[model samples]
Target: MSSLSILLVEDDTIEVMKLNRTISKLNLNHTVIEMKNGELALEYLNGDHKLPDIILLDLNMPKLNGIDFLSILKEDNELKHIPTIILTTSCNQKDLQECYNLGVTGYILKPLRYEEYVTKIEKIVAYWSINELIQKK
Candidate 1:
């Protein structure tokens, strides 16, 4: 699979470190751009920087939560095509349904175990890296 440019919007420092460690351990050369909150992520996205291939979003945050961020993202014509996956701990059915309704590509519950998290991340990276994504001009 080709290396991917991943936009990870997460609030927890530990989770960020865990993801980076997992990626390094797997020896995947994907470029990760980290944002601590949805507001910061939006600011980055709106800037002149190149867009990421996929977005890994966490649901609960202090400012502009994932659902709100997703809502804003999907409404934008230039930014809507990027596949967004919810990498969250919430198992709320309403949250799941809402995300899908707003056109989220996937919803994955964060596992407690490190091994399980690694496995899930591996699969996620493998799948998205192989898929032909929409090329936003």
Candidate 2:
């Protein structure tokens, strides 16, 4: 299997660190590209760089929020194919509905416990990896 590439757009330094540690501990056969804000993420996605298989997007960000980013992404022909997952602290139903409406593949609330967070991420990675393989087959 090819290593999965993940683009993570999160603004909080603490959250970023936690996610980085979780990914490292999981030892997932994936490459993670990190960005601090939605605008920067959009720039990266629009550039000549290879598109990530999955995007781990945070809802609240500077310059542009996840909903706005998703709206733009869904409209772009070149970027519409990539799957985006909302990984956020908010569990608001309205936000969830909005994300689904904007075509996010998944929505995961940030876990308060470190162990739970790692476990959740692992499951997400496993599911996506398997799903991709099945699609190819």
Considering every candidate listed, which one attains the maximal lDDT? 1
**lDDT for every model?**
0.95, 0.88
* Weakest 10 consecutive residues of candidate 2 by summed lDDT: 128-137
TM-score of each prediction: 0.97, 0.93
Q: Tens digits of per-residue lDDT for model 2 on 46-83?
A: 99998888899999998999999999999999988788
- Using TM-score as the measure, the top candidate is 1
All-Cα superposition RMSD per candidate: 1.4, 1.8
Ten residues in sequence with the least summed lDDT for candidate 1: 128-137
Candidate 1 lDDT: 0.95
Evaluate model 2: give its TM-score: 0.93
Clashing pairs in 2: none
Question: Model 1, 3-61: lDDT tens per residue?
Answer: 89999999999999999999999999999999999999999999999999999999999
